[model samples]
Target: MVNLGDLNNDIPFDVLSRLPTKYMPKLKCVSKGWNRLISDPTFMKVQSQKREQLSGFFFQQKYQWCYDDITTISYIPVEKQDAELHKTVFNFLPEHVVVLASCNGLLCCRSCFPFHDSCLYICNPLSNEWLRLKWDEPNKENSFALAFDPCQDPIATPTNFKLIRVKQFETDKEALCFSFEIYSSDKGAWRKSEEICKCNNNLYKNRGIFTEGVLHWLTDGDEVLTFNVENELSWLVSVPIPANEFRSIPESCIGDSDGRLHYILVSEYGLQVWFLEDYFESRWSLKLCKTLEEMEEEHSQFLYNLRERVTQRLAVDMEPWIDPLAFKDGPLFCFTIATFHAHFSILEENLCSKFLTSCTQTSSLLHGKAIHAKFIKGSIPHSLYLQNHILNMYVKCGDLINGHKLFDEMPERNVVSWSAMVSGFTQHRFYNEALSLFVYMLRDGTSRPNEFTFVSVLQACSLHESLALAYQVYAVVLRLGFGSNVFLVNAFLTALMRHGEKEEAFEVFEKCLNKDIVTWNVMLSGYLESSCLELPKFWVQMNNEGVKPDCFTFASVLTGLASLGELNMGLQAHGQIVKSGHGGEICVGNSLVDMYIKSQRLFDGLKEKEEMAVQKKQAEVRPVGTLVQF
Candidate 1:
């Protein structure tokens, strides 16, 4: 194999730039030269430009009936090539991010759980490069828009970007008005923009279109709201067509297409597309007009072509109505269709799988249910992998009713499917249910219990304090030749110890050849809790085995020694903790303080307590503007 660095830098640059951005992070390990090449900000920008494409529209739908305002944001890709791109687009971000705005491939996102002051982050999902904005006024509810134009100079290192925050305030006359706060990347701080645009009509807060260094938003009134980022000025232009008298509200939106502004209007008859021919003259020209029948016919043809390529049949029960969302380059238009039951999207099987995994990881029940509904409506064949993922999502999200329902409805079951449900039941404290499912899994004879399956069942037994059930499970484990398996032995030992069968737990521990830190900790904790006199002997044996003690071990030993008023043993444990580098841990410190106090060393205990308090204070006073690189 040839080294990437051995060739000219341009050769490697061209090859690496063409690869997908998701795979770029892993390529850093190829060589130091490759790492440096990929780390360059200029190379990342070029790669982002090549790999990032406007494939979809992300829209938020609000469910008013929910007690808390629940907004479901989803993406619908326009082209087939970008169908799977949405799965990993925002996965690199640390927290759940609500996409506030998008401009030139950079997404302005705010943390879903804004527990801190700096919740806003401007990120390029393609390259996984992000910058957190210093947001001091987190308490104030403000609408934000992003404006990013790539640097024109070839030698420029940093890209220049701007963020516009609009806050609504009440005037002395009790009329609503908006004020502007602008943050520029070059200045690295936020400044108040003197210009303020006042409008009584409620502006669409979430949606903003950025083009030609200007951001636009549609207002309730028949006007277009505009903000120029460079000059920090706000203005309004009259709409091409005013709201009709009969219709109290009109379905209209604004978008940028090929560097020019375009307006779309939906009426009972059909849809009309208008282009802003001249911004200075405020001139408008009708670009395209279509009747409702014509639009439906085109949609039907598109769906028909899609159906031909798909082997599965489409659902015939639901009627979906489409709403045009935005216009892209050429004839590409992004739209969203909603049925009576759920929103519809043509998600590929793998994409559905990824969405289910994300939902499971986040415990997002609502999103999981929506994806399941879409899967059913799309009539995709349920592979065992997808079915297991869906089941796991439901179970992990604590929706056991739906999880069991889906499990029962599944045509086939595998060991993974059984293990997930069993684990879910045990995790949610449904001990009896978990045991019953384990028994049923055995009776079904389709799948056999693996180590993971046994782990959950043993945990359920231990938590339920069912020694008889644990014995039976252990017999099965022995028969399956897993008696020496360290994990199974540990679980077995835990069950025995929890039921006060220390002798049996010790016997199991002695027979196991491979023991990890957890095994030692489990035995040591059980002995300490039961006041077993063999604790000292066991600790010496652990040291003889060359197994290092961690914070938990030191804490347990210190607590036991303190209870018995053994100051010498406690002091020895403290020295071990210090040598092991666990003395600074909060748990270890608390243990040491307790041990010192119980031994009548009042001065030492108070000194340790004061040290802990000072350390915590210093941690709390640390600066918050530290840059976090992903």
Candidate 2:
């Protein structure tokens, strides 16, 4: 047997690069040589090129409420493996982080706190590393776009990244002038560019697309704002389509495919895809055009009652609207249909499993129902995986009645089907039903409970206040080799704490090998909720472990301090909160106010309250059109 050491380094390098990126970290532990090979910049670039094609797209949707608007970023993948890998790409970031833009494998995120100074973070989810940008001018409502091309630099470094911030300024003549402030990782600071572009129409602040060393933003007029990152020049290119054909709200978007710029136009007629055949010559080529009737005929089952639903909303004057989102390398396009309710749909050759999963993830009940109707009519092929997705969609959309009926009618049940139903029941407060389903699943022996199944069942046990059942489930979890799942362990700890089993919960916590921030928060909050005098001791232990506290942790600790009237400790905690950049979190702010008021610092408390009120009013008054609401 020849040792790897005897083989050429290229042999090992080529073999390792073929493995999934998720396993790279573990492979680094094999030896120092392997670690160095994997850590090399060149090796990373090669591996990235060898990796799979563009897996999916991350899109943001804003939901407007009476007081404020909440923006959420969601990922939809084209393949199941990609879904499992990239769905939680941003979960590792702090809560309330809004993704500003993405290029290559990097994401630019901003803190979404209304009152505090905004912070920007550039992170690589695959590598689980992030860097915070120095952004002092948080009050400026400027647009930002990220540009990074892996092929540009052989030796990749942070300096290879560029962030462009566009701020609109008015001249004495009242013309709309936009200035560019660029942040280069190499320079380690932001510099003002002398290039200024004047336009008659406003550019969409958040909708910037970077492709081929050029950053493009769609303008309110019939032009696109193109900025060359290398030359630091700005110009506008006329949209390929006629100006009058565009809608007032601008349903068209610019996307990049195969290193060429493509413009997507959404109109009452249908969707048109135009490619820039020659950027220099300003030549455009019509690649694909589908009429509304053609689209409806092709996706009739999916858009079954879309027109009827829009008619019911009395938007008879308004035609069915489609918003172009993202365009991939091939013919695939991602977009949303608005028929009173927004439904996400992918225009692909076939309604694949990934599309069904996307609908389930977005809770698009109407689309899911249409697909199910197609399944019933034998128009679409039936599979256990697709059926489970539909069931999950109904359950997530709060149609539990339909969800249960579908579950019962399923020709066969798998682990996913059972787990989805169980989670649904628990989520909708049917704890008894969840417990019953768990028992039935075990008795049937068709499938065994996995980590997810245990999590949901444990939650049900805790909410049902059935400690005995929780203990039984815990035993089964351990026997089934799922004793190491952190999520399952967290749920078990919660169950124990809810029943006043503090000592037992502590034991479980200590036994947990991998304690994430969530684990520590659970223990801290549990102690506070129990009014246990050991709260301070537990807090000290958590600090000793060097677990960074988040907004939730700060909120819990401050609440306990307030109840105990520990003003001095509360002050120190408040300083830490600010230092950690969680000062803008509404939960933390509210807790700060509570602590100050409880400690008789009425002036400070009142000041915080007033500031929060002002911020709330600002958010409420902001124009809805400026927001990217679904």
Provide TM-scores for the models.
0.54, 0.49
Q: What's the lDDT for residue 58 in model 2? A: 57
Candidate 1 lDDT for residue 494: 88
Error of 2 at 544 (Å): 1.3
lDDT per residue (tens digit) for residues 1-630 in model 1: 877655678888889888866577679889998888888877876864442344455544443223233445554455442232233456777866667777766788876655656578898754578988766756425678887765332124334788888777889988877788888888889989898887887785346788777888888788888898888888888788887642323466787776678887665445678988766667899998886566556655223333222223222211112333233211122122222113223544554565566566545566677667656666545588888988999889899998999999989999999999999999999999999999999999999999999999999999998999999999999999988888888888889888888999998898899999889989988888788477777877988889998888888778777887878867877888878888677888999999999889999999989988887777684422211111
For residues 1-630, what per-residue lDDT tens digits would candidate 2 score against the true structure? 977675778888889877766577778899998888888877886765553455455555544335344555555454443232233557777656767777777788877664455579888765667888867767435688899876553233432899999888899999988889999988879899999999878885456788878998888787888899999998888888765753333256677766678887655556678888766666789988986567667656444543333323322111123322232222123223322123323222234454556566655555567666656666456778778877888888789999999999987999999999999999999999999999999999999778889999999999999999999999999998899999999999999888889999999999999989889888888888898477767777888888899999999999988888878878888889878988778898899999999999999999989877876676673411110111
Top-scoring candidate (TM-score): 1
Runs in model 2 deviating more than 4 A are 1-350, 614-621, 624-630
Alpha carbon lDDT of each predicted model: 0.72, 0.73
The RMSD (Cα, Å) of candidate 2 is: 20.9
Predict model 1's lDDT versus the native: 0.72
